[model samples]
Target: MRRPLLPPTLALVFALWPSTGCHLLLDGEPAAGIGAPCEQDSQCQAAQCIDEVCASPCSTSAECPAPATCTMAGLCQLPLRAAFVHVGDPATEQWTQAHEIGRQAAHEALPYLQTEIATNKLLASDAASAIDDFVARGFPVIIATSPTLRDVAALKSAEHPGVKFLTCGARSSATSNNIAYSGRMYQAAYLAGFAAARRSATDRLGMVASLPTPSVVRYINAFTTGARRASPAALVEVRWIGFWHDTLPPDAQGKTRERVLTEALLASGCDVIAHQADNGIPVATVAAASLTAKAIGNNVEDACRDDATSCLGATYFRWGPLYTQLLDGIHRSRWPAATLVELGMTLNPAHSTVNFTLNAGSGSSELAIEISNLLQELAAEGGETVPFLGPLCSTGQRDLDADGTPDCLDPGQAPDPQELQRMCWFVEGLVEKQDPADPTSEDRPALVPTTGDCAR
Candidate 1:
């Protein structure tokens, strides 16, 4: 059927209307897409728009126009189909904290998109299956929570080259799609130790741990360093429970494993206790119920808020904003291959991925204020002045660098990130203990078991 012709003015307006969407041209307005601003995904030619600016994905800077450089994810905007995977229930502390934070971030940042939290028991096979489901759904970005999923993440990365697998507590820093994401918890640990030392009446700090990986080792060593700085007589003791968590009960000795270790440390006059496992509740409980001991716990967002007086402060994990960046890359369709995110307060405490929260109490009263000032110094000037300086001595009073000079004397010798991550040595002040022989020889061990997580 032929349509009737419009008047001259109406005909001119129709000719100038945007072809992308059936909308009449507005006065002094540029059309959506084709290098123009956009409000949402539906308004762009690329089906992706962020921050009121349309992203044009490209490989090289030359391909991107001025003021828009090629991002780390290789895209101009974040991806749409982003999902988070965890081994534990969403309510669990360390294993599922990312799920809670991810949900919050998605609601605010990617509200138009539906973000999923795929929960599983997280054995090797289960991890593989979870990745398969996400891949089938065409999710370009996956943020894995538990360290137990490392091997599974690697295998799936090989299977699906397009997926970006960002993980916390990863065992390795592989340069492939299995991106490594870690917060400088040692920086926070240093603050926690100083706080503990200030609170300790016995001048001792103890740690109940699951594994002795470099990450864990770094935490213990940094705590020891900070504690010593606060109190010259301060000492640190560590005991690993033979696993990452309290997954197993004790033998015929009526030991819950944790009870046994806590009793032993307290008997030895250890006044402050910390745990490196998932939830900080147990640590808080142990400290509150103890006779003279206090607690320094982690993942406090999930554990310590209820009982503020049980211990000193919590070494909080800040993964939400970090996880948001991974989603941003996924939406932009440009995941970088070999990126390692090592965030610290030195970058900006207001925006740091980790920190300590010590409420005022007689145990940690003015010490918390002192530690806060120390943190400001630690975070200043790129944070090179961290406590594990060289001319540094090891557990046996031997020079850590194996040279005649110590870190304190050298001034140029401080443990760097990789050095701290690979540290297996204890500092000078810690008491000699029955840990793995030659700790320096084995800085990082298997973060998870090969057949664990019910892998059939």
Candidate 2:
């Protein structure tokens, strides 16, 4: 079992230098400027365009790191501040990337911010208490991650409206100082699907997901949708482990189950596989499998040392730019509690919040290079890369409009913001359909003895 954190860890007191780039921002959001569409990834100032937006990379500091500020023009360079506090540890792959590494990356860009990194038990009350402690200590910007903290975060934000609070995986009312935002991973996931599909020998692809929520739903749908678009006849298979960051039980069982799922997929003839869960067990599984197959990682950009050089890279983020944006908003224009910001990817190399990386070694192959180039083109601005929209089918039960009737989307239609955020259905093109009534169909629980589990 992981040991409890004894004290607040002040990870570092580093200075930040702004990322060098020119960007266009509208009310602090990335916008395409009058510049000609970028011809390649490196041509852009902000290393973004992962979403095909031919604009400056970031709209705010959350996209870049601290000490680095994102200007209204979408540049991440003016010096910036505390004011930031991150709660969570690196014990689990998901938490590590989301909190540990996320903090470091954000700070690297926003160097002026005096940030605090704290870890508590995997419980909401504990998280809330930690935030309370930080609030007492005068940390005005509190970035609280973890499902356990979602509800309490809303309450705490209300209790201390003077404080800037942020939450993930859930929404806060639009009337408070608290705001919620999520990574638009589906955009990158679609690219991964397309890459995996192109490399498949059997046209069978397997994916291991974290949970059944809309985020995971979007990831799965985008992936399969992209795979099908590329391979045409490829089959996308999926499995789940029943929770997010299952660090309870403190045993290898959770990990073992994750691997078994991969083995089962491979055994069933999947030649290319992807894993989108938090702990990144799939990286190890896909890397270690004796069978030769293409593997993809999600969420974290860095290669796993345990499986160095084995992965095709991963879909990653730079929360510093985005977080930096939130801080600026709070200091300048106070946000009502329930603000929502949905950021997509751009093709800037250093500043893209979302990026697709392939192993340098594997990328040398003609096919690997081909996949890499294809991703670049697809992610390039002004391309036909809407993997989640139109001519779709639903793999899970869905009620997009919430009318008395539920329906699968037909051709010429797409899942809207509500549908995507709610993520009640999967896009068409799975190897097999699943029961909407299945317990594992939606929401997973945590491993520890928590008061609530997303457990279906």
Candidate 3:
């Protein structure tokens, strides 16, 4: 027996309907057309429907319009023109601010280069995904700002040998066409320490830190050593904040800790405070400003907005020129594949952008002069000053290897990479080390100079 003829409306709807495509429903019947509500198979003109949305079936680039490719994510996307990307944490607004300056300079220097910035609290997986996405889009260069993302970059570089990756503030053991590593902040930090020492009043100093990582530890030691060189009677006390990414509560807590530490040091006669802590400046500055008796400022020269203040100058990092240099390298194809690039306060060779700043007040002009001289000496010597190498010893009779030979100062002596990597002892004359287990200690780590070099 023949089936009864379907209604004209139903028949028309079914004819245009797709078996598994997106469609629109009209007048209680299935519909098939663009911009129509759709469901499974019998509802749309296209066989593929997604959440009532209809589109042409696409399995590859040929199935899509020109310049569009079916992404693995199952969507058509425009082809990416840039070949490089940079990832940074937006939370590190201060640090990233400097980096963005460099990015801008880079763009200016290399008008033809393209770059994309990704900001987030990057995880290893997130880094992997970012690299994968970039690679899939034909990007050949990736720059990561945080140390934590280094490993992922290394892994991705290994997986894709043709890609090039650069990491700032991260050191890696792996070497490949895809990786370049550098962390030259130590040079700047050493100079800043000298500036801090030249500005102290009581000769007792304070340093606030964000973590005990090698980079931070190195800066702390260098600062303390520099202070000692300027004022033998100077004592540097350090507090570790235990975190790199500054947070509000802990940051405030670090400030509180700085206040308490400064008070204790002041009670014991400390008059100046400096810090290696990222974003610890606000807290340290506030504490310094709050003090009725002492001077305050950290990395940058402390130039208080108020005239009647004792805020010394501060040391500021400028990243814009450096970024521009890298971009230039990429554009000119002069970028070294596996070399570590170190950028400093010196003018950028390609763009002449200065990447360092100091904010010493007029009262600290003498200190600034001394610091400038020291920097010049260091630069003249090709960055060869080692503050801790000296006829040095701790206050506690920690004699230098029993022969009275200074650990760091003997010619040709340098700390072992491993020891330098895990420094924990406080230098002689410093007040305290932030105890990892002690809640009472500041959230930052303290560093002190030691009396031994490479057993030379």
Candidate 4:
């Protein structure tokens, strides 16, 4: 049946309107093929639009058209689909940004492995929904980039037995199909601590920290232990900001919680400041807070790169190798065994997952040489000279094991992996201030600085 013609203005409006619910163009030139440009799956005959191009789902190269090999993501054109679950703003959060950088690198290195990121998944339910969506879309790999999402990933992994899951910085016990991995970041923190202590004239240091989690506690303990080796008189004062990233409302002075907390630490007479939080705000605040004070950074190298003179050094993570290894495993059909791996220099000597960078402009050449020697010693076989070695006592001197002995590690005795994984106590010489109003008040942990020789 012939339809009636519309008015000129109405005809132009209909012509300009975007076509939807159909894969054919107005001219009816067949259907958009795999190489055709598309904005959505509905616009393509293949029903898959990836990276702005029509793609056909394929499990192997034989299933794809000639000259187009199948990617690990089961797509003819795009690579394997890997998704990273983020809790904070990657642009503003250093930790999440670091993982994002790694994601980009992994995509670059393994063209067969494509990547996607889902942000603002602050709650377990939010992350679970995102993960489920990714799984429904045939994403084979999921990397939960926060400890908070560790349990969420675990439960999802159990539900999706074929999918591989990796949880970063989680101390949880490994499950049958989930891989728990974290870098040995405390080693780098120890190095940064030594540099900070060497640059401090008053032997008083400050650290802006988040919650007292096991990983955070390990970093603080290693840093304090390193500082004490450099200066026995070193005393570390800690301020808890109660979050992994800065998100608090501005104060009356228009300063953020990070800045306000740093100022309070500076007011307490700390000469050098360090931070375990996931941003450079604390470091930048130190630059503006005082002319003589210094800062040590964490989780990223930009701290020293941004202000070499003001920042002594920083402990950073390089996740590229780890991600590459995992993705390549999928490519080779050699998925990693489900277990917990604490990757360190001992395991990754070629390119460490964790590293420390120093600013030569801020410290003397002697200090650099000392740090280099210390790093070599630490990297040597068995970690005998590691900073966590004892004759160490808690600042509060509470009995940890309840065996009627003070919670002190005797000389030549080192903390086992299980004990370190659950450490919530501080070593001696730390001036821990507890604010009942803080979110981390339930965990009243402290830091410690050693006196005299720890070997004694």
lDDT of each: 0.61, 0.58, 0.50, 0.72
**216: Cα error in model 2, Å:** 0.8
**Predicted candidate 2 versus true structure: per-residue lDDT over 84-139, tens digit per residue:** 33344466555445556656665554333457666654576777777888889877
- Candidate 3 lDDT: 0.50
Predicted structure 4, TM vs. truth: 0.77
Off by over 4 Å in 1: 1-52, 55-79, 171-175, 250-255, 336-338, 346-350, 360-365, 382-385, 396-409, 432-456
- Which lDDT tens digits does candidate 1 get at residues 1-456? 112211121111111112222112233333224233456666666434545445555676565444344555454332255667778775665646644764575456443244677785567787777779988987766767777777778777777866667776675645366777777788888888888888888886777766656677677778887898889888776766766666775658855676667666665667888777765544645654685677776864435556566666777766655555555434333344445666665434435567777754634346655876887877775444466776666653224466765334255477666666566556766663434343333222122112232121
- Give a tens-digit lDDT track for model 3, residues 14-127: 112123212122343222343333455454443344433333445675664444445453433333233333344434444555456666665654433457776663568767
Error in Å for residue 196 of model 4? 0.9
Backbone steric clashes in candidate 2, count: 44
Q: Total clashing residue pairs per candidate?
A: 18, 44, 40, 1
Maximum-TM-score candidate = 4
Q: What CA RMSD would candidate 1 show? A: 12.4
Off by over 4 Å in 2: 1-88, 91-95, 172-174, 248-255, 331-338, 363-386, 399-406, 432-456
Write model 4 residue lDDT over 1-456, tens digit each, in one string.
112211121111111112211122223322235544456777667446665456677778887664455766576653456889998777878888888877886776665676889998879999999999999998878999988788899899989977878888665544555778787788887888888899998888988877768788778888888899899889888877777765668878798888888887787678899898888988898888789999988776676666677888888887776777666545433444546666664333335667787866888899989988888867675333457877888876446667767677889777887777766667775775576244333323464322211110
When sorted by lDDT, best at the front, the candidate numbers are 4, 1, 2, 3
Query: What order do you get sorting by TM-score, best first?
Result: 4, 1, 2, 3
